[model samples]
Target: MENPITRPRSVERLVAGQATSDGAGVKLTRVLTQDLQRRLDPFLMLDAFRNENPEDYIGGFPNHPHRGFETVTYMIAGRMRHRDSAGNEGLLGPGGAQWMTAGSGLIHSELPEQEEGLMEGFQLWLNLPAKAKMCAPGYRDIPPPAIPEYVDGAGVRVRVIAGDSGGVAGAVRRPDTEPLFLDLHLPAGAGFGQALPAGHNAFLYVYRGSVIVRGAPVADRHMAILGNDGDGVVLQADGDSRVLLVAGRPLQEPIVQYGPFVMNTAEQIHQAVRDYQAGKFAAAAVQAF
Candidate 1:
């Protein structure tokens, strides 16, 4: 059996996300904002949206530009059609994901493929290192079957999205940020553990139900930032719960962001803006079907 977290980290604080709308006014909760970028280095933002009403998400996201970071869109329900200037097009359905690296720049749109029912998912912005901020843009469409998942003896199911868990590797991996993204579903009264580097910044966002970490209750739609003093974390489900566990090694470098552009300095941000305005962002192509 894989070794469990011996010293589980405690919750540093609980954060109530701010309700916001983006991309043609699609309603969402911005869980991680610009203010927390330093504390949660390598991760810029996290937006969660769950809407049953068609009016809330029908507009979807129109053509937008991004540079110097990566966008990971994971869909729990509903379907979204992705098209980009890189000549890439794909349909993201339930249990699928779209990973786009706007390394240098790109123009993309994510429109709804369905007219009704439930629309739920998250969009996470992971910052790139200084060295890779201006690299070639890329994209990947990861279907549900491509993602590595495992069910533990305690009836806890874990979907490893971007890190190693329970001896199962995720579909994508990065060396610089070394991000760990896991979607965990735990049964009532069950527990789960995952080892993490003591130096990495980590947090847990509970979505379905409540969970307890280090004796602190994390309610639905709330985020619990974990302390970095321990080797890992232990979570106990207060009920049948679904949570997102995310961690990454801090870049420790300067972060300067302007809208969808994230760079190391203000000058770089300015350059990105000028480049996008000059139509330089659409030059590169990413074959992401």
Candidate 2:
């Protein structure tokens, strides 16, 4: 069958991810940083980490506080143990995912569960709307089998992580953002397309091999921000490639962030800091995973 996208969006620009370390010296590439948060509304950050050496990711992320946002961690090949103040605990293994909403506040830890071999994954931060910012915190651990997948005739496989794709519903979905998170695996010379709302902000990050968008090459470890002129996107793989396609409706609200806390105003950010320091972040118990 022909690709669904008729007017594929062009590449606005190519972005080379910045190398950084987080979560106790775990080296990673920050694909979506603070500067691009506004350009990609309803989404804040995207960090990709792949390490074969245990020393690189051994330290893991200790207990840290977060508020006014949501975190989605997708594991490509690794085991991570997540524990939060709300008594939620889960083991995220290969091809699994964990979604946590730090609505109000919570302290959590993500530690590696493996001693050696390859560890690869991506973590995305999705902002909560002003109304739902203070709602109760929530958590969900989705195993590999639970995530919906779609395979086309051309051997293009897509894992629908957070939205509908090819008539398949993802494991999790949110209300305000209506975010679409898809992981695509394309064979050499294969092509895949997805229809995206024209108003949504979208981007694609190539993690393996390379792909072409509107004749623009997006190499491995590089990101291609899609222009808003088109309704969807069509990607052609130069070789066996794997890429992440993320899009979400803009919140179009003020974004004030301080470290791990995100709010709409400076005062709200300050309040989050004060609340975390005052031991009020975990005052209420949340539902278990």
Candidate 3:
């Protein structure tokens, strides 16, 4: 599909993270959202935090409430324990993921489980469909091994987390927006391009190294939002660069966000909270195909 946006240019967005305690008994970093207003459809927020010092991490996040959305927590280093009101419990290590669909409502929290005090991870909020907004809650905790990762040796390493990338399909169940994630690392001076379907929005986040997009240079810790209209995306690495490509079809829904909750209307958001508080949340039923 031809992209409506021109060849991707490197535009930098603001960056922000949160300070929280986890398993290791120390404080760590995490993200909330870079700029206000939803830039990506279906996706409402992105948080990235990293800490190496013991006291800087380890305490972990305590119990919190969520409704009308899906919370996806991904870990790249260290360990985290997950416990929720739905009776889901697990530990996530490097490459681990916990995808929880908090339909009507659910309360949960995550904390670090080790004493090293070093933890790094991310949590993303995805909007649920209106019809599914009242569906019962469900959980999916997948280890790093379940996610497909391979080296494209011509200097590309890819980890397919949700959709097909380089013939590798992410093991996670497809969501409403059909999200695609790729952990791409390229050699210095290498140029990479991919064919992206029309109507999909893509962004490149530089975890490390540097890249020159459309004659513009972007460094580490900066996120590049690509134009949605174009044939594909071209990223040229000026140095050994490691980046995350998060792409999904735009969600054309009205978003009314309040703190940790995202919904289509203020009344709907208010009703969601009331349902949870009144112990009236919808229960997840095991449906057979």
Candidate 4:
């Protein structure tokens, strides 16, 4: 029998992350910024925040406002409490995730639940097209148990957060974006391959050990932007490796972003600022996803 998997997507380029601070005063590694390299359509930013020192993340994220995009926060360790102006509150512990869509606008805060230990997580920003930018503001708070996991015979485990993997689909329900966010752990010498939407843009971020992505080596804290020509990605573990794979459809529309706002034009950005200043985020008004 012959294998049907598509040719593995190769790495087009490697992006080195930088140290940065965000969310009140949280220290983090800015892995993929919107301005770096060519624009990664539909994805605005990717930040990895991991620290053993409480001082590094103790400040947490104070109340803040966002509009025109979605923020996905996945916690691998520690606990975070999220509260929004709509009176909705939730606690995200290890293996938990939160997908908050700030359509027109919203105000929220994420604070640490404990004093110390190993605090680690990733916050991803996904862009919305012009039609859905101001539709409604809503959120999906997913516990660890809600996320789907797939394990292969070779000891490779995949946590599917927003897309299908190994025939198992994630519980995250974002109709407009329909993105794929996965965390993969492969044992030493194990290999993994999965098909992806051909039209979607994809990238891989390695945060542990080393892995061979489409025949190219990717070490810790490095990001590999995959070529768009392939329909799937193949990776092999040089050692015990952990990585995050993210992909989403490109809107192919003009994107103008400022601070927490993302829009199609400069005028829309100014309007968003004025809307925030007028205290429009006081109400939850988050629309159903």
Worst 10 residues of 1 by lDDT: 280-289
lDDT of 4 by residue, 1-289 (tens): 0113567788998987889999767999998887851357889899998899999998899999989889999998999999998777899999999999888899999999989799999999998889989977888889998899978888898999988888888877566556999999889988888787878889999889889986799998899998887878888889999999998888888888898888999999999999989998777576554
Estimate the overall C-alpha local distance difference test score of candidate 3: 0.69
Q: How well does candidate 2 match the true structure in TM-score terms? A: 0.98
Clashes of each: 0, 0, 26, 2
Per-model TM-score on C-alpha atoms: 0.98, 0.98, 0.85, 0.96
Q: Write the per-residue lDDT of candidate 3 for residues 28-138, one digit (tens) a residue.
A: 344335343367666776666567775666557776677777878878788888887767789989878878888767777787777775567677777787777767777
CA lDDT, every model vs. true structure: 0.92, 0.92, 0.69, 0.86
Backbone-clash count (model 3): 26
Q: Which tens-of-lDDT digit does each residue in 7-116 have in candidate 2?
A: 89999989888999998999999999999999999899999999999999999999999999999999999899999888889999999999999999999999999999
* Candidate 3: residue 180 Cα off by (Å): 0.8
Residue 285 of candidate 1: its Cα lDDT? 62
Give lDDT for model 1. 0.92
Q: Would you list the clashing residue pairs of candidate 2? A: none
- Please give me the total number of clashing residue pairs in predicted model 1: 0
Better of 1 and 3 by lDDT: 1
